[model samples]
Target: MLKHVQVRSSSSLLRPGGQKADTLSINSNMSFCSLHEPALSSRSSSYTSLNETQSSTGSASVPAAPPTTTVKVYTRCLRPDLEYKTMSVKYTTTCRDLVDQLLNKYRMKHRDPNLFFLTMEVATRSTGTAVRTILVLDDDSCPAQLQACYPRADSKFTVRMRHGGLVKVYDSVLMAESQYKSLLVSDRTSVDQLVQLLLTCYKSNESVHNYSLYEVCRTTSFERKLHADDRPLAIQQEWSSLAEYSFVLMKRPPGTPRSGRDFPLRRSFLQWSRNRELASWSGREISVIEERRSKSHRSPSLSLAPARKEGEKSFYI
Candidate 1:
């Protein structure tokens, strides 16, 4: 009788620790020795394929960072002195974005973004005179792109408060003689609001209604009182190119109309009076007068009073 047998070789099978065993089995019709070898190779290939797929998928999902640029921003509106700050921003950063960054850097994040803007100052020498032209950039405009437009001129970027312009506010009552405050204003800000702001800045307990804002032009020697509903910023912008304008805050004159016809003479008189008062009370004169007054007030009748020096005289004599 013919008998059928099966044989298996342990050398081709993966043992518990992936070691080859010294055992064999024989099969007459088929060979089972390489059966486990294919299974192990297939599993390894599938695992390698899975790891590659995972790596490719992870690399494809992540995004690359955009390019950045460095810019210098001059900030003159935040303080009396000019300041410049350097920042790292994206090339596509807009004027509005730069303004926000500047405000945040200066610890003024709580302020309104609309109150500030970016400007480009182009300084050129024309007709042997130095001329400067300031152009206000739109909020959507890109600062980095605009800077590239002017390659030869001395151009600089500055952050300014969105005002008609910088106006000098003279408050003779609150401030010292010939001293004034610089204020930034918007075109829509009215005289009443400006007066209130000035009062708040000076920390005065006076009523806003009692004060009036006057526009004084030194070049034209003209003066006018601004109405409550009048926009001082707009007026300033209009007269900006024509003359040097300043704002004067003072008490509202009684029985006087808002025409401001006689205000100039009144202002002059007030200035003269102030000058006279200042001239009459000089530092040396004040000290001498104070000394005489102190001596006259001292009691000469006191027996404990020390005798006067050789050159000194008693107030009673």
Candidate 2:
């Protein structure tokens, strides 16, 4: 919604000094002071002679500058369910003045004056990076009145989502980790979420030490017991397992050996289940599927395109 902030002298408390005077008075004493002798028509020539004997002088005072009132104007959609968020907001000149007026209007009327920290942030748009001045205010202060004062303030002073840009995050979570426990496959993913995912992890046992930003944007995996789905493991590269901060994660179920990407197998693994009844009657659900690539010592140009257009069918899932 379009917000309004008005700047007028008589209606609001002006910008520190822009207050207007209700009346004006000319100095009447100037007429009788005899500082300058009145012109003599027929009767006033006597006054010129009196001033030469007068010992004191009086001066006229210059009028003070009028006080200006500014109000700040801004817009926000209230999402009451959100917790404290480190979101970006912008203020125009109108909004800044509004905030300034609001700050002054809502200061302390109690036994103790309200204390707050004023901090500002700017909009990051192609319009060019502008700096914002933060004017902290007391809780439940009357922002409406503040906006009422500086109606003509600039919109550049405040920030908005359109002005800044989208923010991104990477992390992992268990589907039922909310309800159960399971293995730690690579856990990384992004939510169209705010700085909240971080808070959620912080509040729970889910840790970030295991998270990593990768070649792709992000990678995430939930536990099997909490297995939201049974897709093959993500394309885990050799480096994924050998990173300096390698996690001693449990191997995936042999029945669900992760596929895709270039990976190697060292120790042999068997399909085994923790459940006794299920372990007794199983055979390898394994199948052979070969991937052909360019022979080594071949130039990249030749290796880039495979020797064959494609391969025959492996198996139908």
On TM-score, the candidate that comes out on top is: 1
Name the regions of candidate 1 deviating beyond 4 angstroms: 1-50, 53-63, 123-132, 164-317
lDDT of 1 by residue, 1-317 (tens): 23478665567666799787667666566434545567667877999999999999999999977678777888877644758787888878998898878877877643546578888987778899978899989999887777677653477888877535555678886666647776666666577767776776666778777878777657435556666777666565544343366778878766765444422332332243234444656687656655765878852221222333576521110
Report lDDT (CA) for all predictions. 0.66, 0.28
> Count of backbone clashes for each model?
9, 39
Clashing pairs in 1: 5-28, 6-26, 6-27, 7-25, 7-26, 7-27, 8-25, 8-26, 163-185
**Model 1, 104: alpha-carbon shift in Å?**
1.1
Q: Which lDDT value does model 2 have at 30?
A: 28
Candidate 1 Cα deviation (angstroms), residue 263: 41
lDDT of 2 by residue, 47-160 (tens): 654564453232234454544433233322112243222312222223333333433444412101111212223332355865444554433443333444443342212322
